[model samples]
Each structure stands twice: as C-alpha cells, then as structure tokens.
Target chain A: MNLVLHNFFRSSASVRVRAALNLKGLAYEHVSYVLRKKEHRAEAFLELNPQGLVPALQLEDGTILNQSLAIIDYLDGQHPEPALLPESALDRAWVRGLAHAVSCDIHPLNNLRVLQYLDQQLGVSEEGVAEWFRHWVDEGFASLEKQLASDARRGRFCYGDTPGLADICLFAQVANNRRFDVDMSPYPTLQAIHDHCLELPAIVDALPEHHPHAN
Target chain B: MNLVLHNFFRSSASVRVRAALNLKGLAYEHVSYVLRKKEHRAEAFLELNPQGLVPALQLEDGTILNQSLAIIDYLDGQHPEPALLPESALDRAWVRGLAHAVSCDIHPLNNLRVLQYLDQQLGVSEEGVAEWFRHWVDEGFASLEKQLASDARRGRFCYGDTPGLADICLFAQVANNRRFDVDMSPYPTLQAIHDHCLELPAIVDALPEHHPHAN
Candidate 1:
C-alpha cells in the first residue's frame, strides 16, 4: 500500500502522524510543505485539502484524510500491531482525552496562523504574541502534568508502559513547547513520559530537525 | 442503572450529553450548577473535575468523567443498543472529525471563560468580543458545511441517516450560535442538519432552556 504524508517538519500535527506511522512499522513517502513560506496556502495544496491544512494523508485508494487524530486512528485501525490506542474502550477514552487536552485545547491557540494573525492584524507586539502563545500552552500542560502525575492510570508512558496514543501526542507537543522555550519544570510527569518516548526509534526519527522542511 | 448528570443548562457540552442520554432512552437525574454564579468553580465541583468544566457524569460507581467527549464515549460504550458511532473505523473517524471540528475548534475559542477573558482582562469591547466569536465559528462552519454537503458519506445526518455523535455536537453548537446572532445563511448544509437534528424528541429535550440554569 502506498501512503503519502504531506507535511511540514515543524507542524506538531504532522509530527504526531509521522510518529504513529513509524510506530506501526509503516513505510511512506514524505512530501514537504514549507508552511512559513505560505506553501500550504498555495493552490496545489488547497486542492488536496480545501481547509488548506497540513498533514493530509493520501491513502492507497488516493483518498485524502485530513485532521491528525482522524489520520492516526485510520492508520491504527489498518495496522493494529504496536497499537496506538489502549485495548479497553474506557482506557481508550482516557488516552484520547489526554491527547485532546493538548491537540484540541492547547495547540490550536498557538498555531502558526493564529500567531501570524496576532502580529499582522491584532497589532500585538512580538513579545506579547509570544507571551499569549505560552500562556495557554502552560495552562494546558499544568493540568496535564497534574492529571498524569496523580492518576493511577499512568505508567512509564502516558498509558501503560507501552508507548500508546497519548504518549505519541504528548511527546510531539512537548517538543513544540520546547521550541517556544516554554518552561518544563512545572510538568515533571510530562518530562518523564517524554523522556521515555524519546528512547524509541520511531519517535526519534520523527523529530522536527529530521524533516526536509526543518531547514 | 441510575444515571445522574451534573451540568448547566446554558452549557453546550451539557446539552450534547443530555441529548445522548435522551437518545439512549436512559432515565437520568439532572444535577444542575449555576455557572455564572461561580458555582462550577466552587471546591465541591472542582473536586469532581479540576478543569471546572460543565457536563461531568456520575456513573453507577460514582466515578466522575470530566471531558464531554470522554463522557459521551463512555456512555456509548456502556450502552451499545443505539450506538453513537458507526460500525466501521473509517466512518467512526469521519464522525469524530466532524465532532471535534465543532467541540475542539469553534467552541473553545468562543467559550464563556475565553470570551470573558477577552472582555475583562484584555478590555475588548462587547462588539469586539462578538466579532471575535463569530469569526472562528464561521471559519469552522464554512469548511464543515462544505464537507458534509459534498461528501456522499452524508445522508440525512452528518454521517448516514442516523443521528449519531457528530449530529449531537452540531445541534448543540448551532443552538449556542443563536445567542450570539451568528448568521447561518453562509452554511446551508449545516443549517439543514441543525434543523433536522432539532426535529428529534431527544434533541428537543436537551435544549439549553430545559437545564436548571436557564431561568
């Protein structure tokens, strides 16, 4: 089966899918989009996803899948070994909730478009925009750290000792946080889980610097 | 099983849960909180969910599930008679993508707390806040309406003929939109789906006015 991942290296959503694909032992071709250069907004990429978002996956049947969570779930369903989600439905919900806490709540607020809009339209100073970006992210991470540290459900990873869905999302987002110089001292459990995830080869390869767009 | 839902009537998330419970024909006791009065932020409620969000479900074991999506999924898993998700994983992903498009993307931006922050802290005027709310909602709904209208996957509902997870989310958010006077003319497919969903008895019972806080 041929899989094409259309992504930018710095995009956390793309990174999540890459890690998921790597974890499943899947081979795919990478097509880079330079988001900073407005390449994703180009007519070519817009045809692939009308929303003009990155991390669009082209399947063997040529059906393009948008949304990182949806794409990861699609891959997980087709390739179950080294499963990204937990076995039980309840466990799955918990892991998904953790993932959403970052993907849904935190990431969107600090995304590239939003940051650009803040600078270009809102007249916010660069420092102000950076502070605004870090604010929402730290709030999310603080809650996540509390949940992970206190919840009995956590293991070496975000779920079981295995690197499951939540671990994949957390690892990628934490990497994004570090780029912004967001303080990690407030989230010890998150740091520990991230450390565990980095030991895996799949996650290591999905690092931002590894992608062609990172330059 | 005795099902009790702790929620506020004005909360869109609570409305979704109420609709789901009604769809499943489960008799649930409503434990309402006055969100505007700082009741949800009280120690008692915060103990249930540190996030202090509405729509926390009290299961038979007194286990509290906080996130609205997690609560809804738990209900679907526990009571599978009238399933909220589709049978195939691909269809399930589609349904979830639509749901998150509203819940994660639009709702969070225009949430009460966030809006309040814009007004109280940032000193944004009432008109400015409303404009901000409408901008994101319209941006999200435009894409969603196009997707639902063009895709063959859509039947009378967001996915097929059944009123499933995505429909529940759409119905609630559209109802909230009315309060902000967000124009629906731009998204006819979304408007049609909203109208169709409201036609159901479950949806009617879940309207914000029925909640304890709606006085």
Candidate 2:
C-alpha cells in the first residue's frame, strides 16, 4: 500500500507516524513541510487536511488521515504483523493510557505552536519558555516513571518485550525533551525504555536527525 | 460487572467517559473529586492513578483505566452493541480523527490544569486566561467545522445517526464552552451536532449538573 507522509522533521507527532510506518515495514514517501516557515499553514496543505497539522498520511486511495494516534491506529489495523497495541481490551487500554500520557498530557503543552504562543503572545522570555517546557515534561515523566517502574507487565518496552504505541509516544517525547534540556534523572524507567527504543533501526530511522529535511 | 468511575463533575474529560458509559448502558458508580480543591491530586487518589488525573474507570477485576478516550475505547471493545467506532478501518480513522481533534488538540490545552498554570504561574489575568481558552477553542473549532461541514458521513451526530466517539467529545467540549462563553455562532455544524447530543438521555445525563456532588 502506497502512503505519503506529510510531515515536519521536528514534530513529535510526525515522529510517531513515521516510526509506526517503519515498525510495520510499510514503505511510504515523505512530503516534508517546514513548520517554522508556515509551510504547513499554506492553502494547498490546508485543502488536504482542514486541521493543517503535520504527519497527515495520505493513503494510496488519496484519503488523508490526520491525528498521529489515529493514523497509528489505522496503520495497526491495516497491517497487524507487528502489532502496535496488545491483545486484550484491557491491555490495549493500558498501552493507550501510556501513549496518551505523552500525547495528550505532555506533548500538547510543549509543542511548537504552544511554545510560540508562550513566547509571542504571553511575552514569556526564552528561559521562561524552556522552564514551561521542562515543567510539563517533569510533571508527566515523573508519573510515567512511577507507573512503568511499578508495573509488572512492563518489559524492555512500555508494554511487553516489543515496542508498541506507548513506546512510540515515549520515544518521541523523550527525543523532543532534549531540545529544552529537560533533566532526565527523575525518569529512569522512561529513560531506559527510550534507550531501548533507540536500539531499534525503525525507531532510530524515524528520529528528527534521520529525516531528509533535518538541518 | 461492577465498575467505579473516579472523576470530577465539570471536567471535559470526565464528561466524555460518563457519556460513553451511559451510551454503552454500562452501570458504574461515581466517585467524585473536586479538582479545584486538589482532591484529584490527593495521595489516596494518586495511588489509584499515578498520573493523578480524574475520570479513571476501575473494573470489577480491579483494573483501572485512565485517559477518557482510552476508557471509551475499552468500553466500546467490551460492549460492542452500540459501537462507538465504525466497522471499517478508514471509517474508524475518520471518527478517531474527529475525536482526537477535541480530546488531544482542544481539551488538552483548555483543561483545568493548563488554565491554572496560565493564571497562577504565567500570571495571565482573568481576561487573558479566558482569551487563551477561547483562542484554542476557536483554532480547533474552525478546522472541525470545515471538516464536518464538508464530510458527507455526518448525520444527526458526528458519524452516522448514532452518538459515537466524535459526538461524545464534541458534546463535552461544547458543554465546557458555555462556561467560557465561546461564540458557537461560527460553528453551525458543531452547534447542531451538540444540540442533537443534548436530546439524548444518555448524553444529557452525563452533564456536570447531573452529578450527585455537582455544585
């Protein structure tokens, strides 16, 4: 199945979809949009996705799938070999809870647009923006560390032995954390899981530095 | 199957889960937490969910499910009679995309914690906090209005005639919007869908006012 990923190199959400596609061993082309240049907000891109968000996967049949988690879910359904979620309903919920802890709780507050808003609209200093970024990460990662460290179900990844949805989100968020110098000492479990994810070629290939448009 | 919901009455996330449970006809007990009083952040509540977020669903088997969408997905999987998502993978993606548009994009930014951070931490005044809230709601609703208005699959609800995931999220968001006085005039489609959701006993019963501990 042909898929074209419309994304930016630095977007954590984009990192998620790219890693999911690579994990599933699905070949897809990249249509890079430089978000800082307002390329994603262009009329043509907006026509494709009303949300105008990065990491919109245009399927072979031209259906534009938005929302990173939703796109990942679709990929998991269409290609189930390397399952992104576990088997049981409860297990899936467990994985999803981990994923949302990053996606909904952390990344939403620290994404580029929100930071830009903090810098421009709120007149926050550069240091203040960095502080805001680290604050949310610390809030999220502290609990994530506690949860992962305490859970018996956790293996090398957030779920079982394999990397799945939670791992994808955790990997992306940790990678993004580096930009703001978020101290990782508090989240040993999260750091270890992130380190394990880095060993996988699929995940490493999806990192920001590995992207074709990365500066 | 005994189930208990740990939640706050006015939380948009809690409202989503309550509506989902009602839609699935699943009976669950409500354990209220006043977010303003830092009740959800209490040691006892944090022990149940390390993330310390409300709207956690505890099953009879003692499995606690966090994240409103994940909890809803779990309910949909276990009780598939009134399915929250469509059958096909692509259709499910569309529904999920709409749901995430609210859950991930809109609600995450405007939730109680984020607003408090803006008010107390950033020192954004009352008017500024309200503007900040409306800013995100408008940004999300504009694209949502465009997408829903242009989609043919939309019916009385966000999907077909049934109240599904998208409608649950949209309903809760619109309900929350009333407190901030968001102008619904710009989103006719969303306003109409929310109005339809209000007519449903399942959805209506999930409103904050119906909660036993509601102020």
Whole-model Cα lDDT of every candidate shown, in order: 0.83, 0.93
lDDT of 2 by residue, B1-215 (tens): 58999999999999999999998898999899999899999999899999999889999988899999999998999899899999999999999999999988989899888999999888999998999899999999999999999899999988989999999999999989988999999999999999999899999999999987799
Estimate the Cα RMSD of every predicted model relative to the unseen true structure.
1.9, 0.9
Q: In candidate 1, residue A82 scores what lDDT?
A: 88
Put down candidate 1 lDDT per residue, B74-110, tens digits, no spaces: 7898899689999997788778878878887788777
Q: CAPRI verdict on model 2? A: high
Candidate 1 CAPRI level: medium
- Please name the candidate that would achieve the greatest TM-score relative to the true structure: 2
Say which candidate scores most in DockQ. Answer: 2
Tell me the tens digit of each residue's lDDT in model 2 across A1-115: 5789999999999999999999999999999999889899999999999998898999999999999999999999989989999998899999999999999999999989999
- Deviation of model 2 at B207, angstroms: 0.6
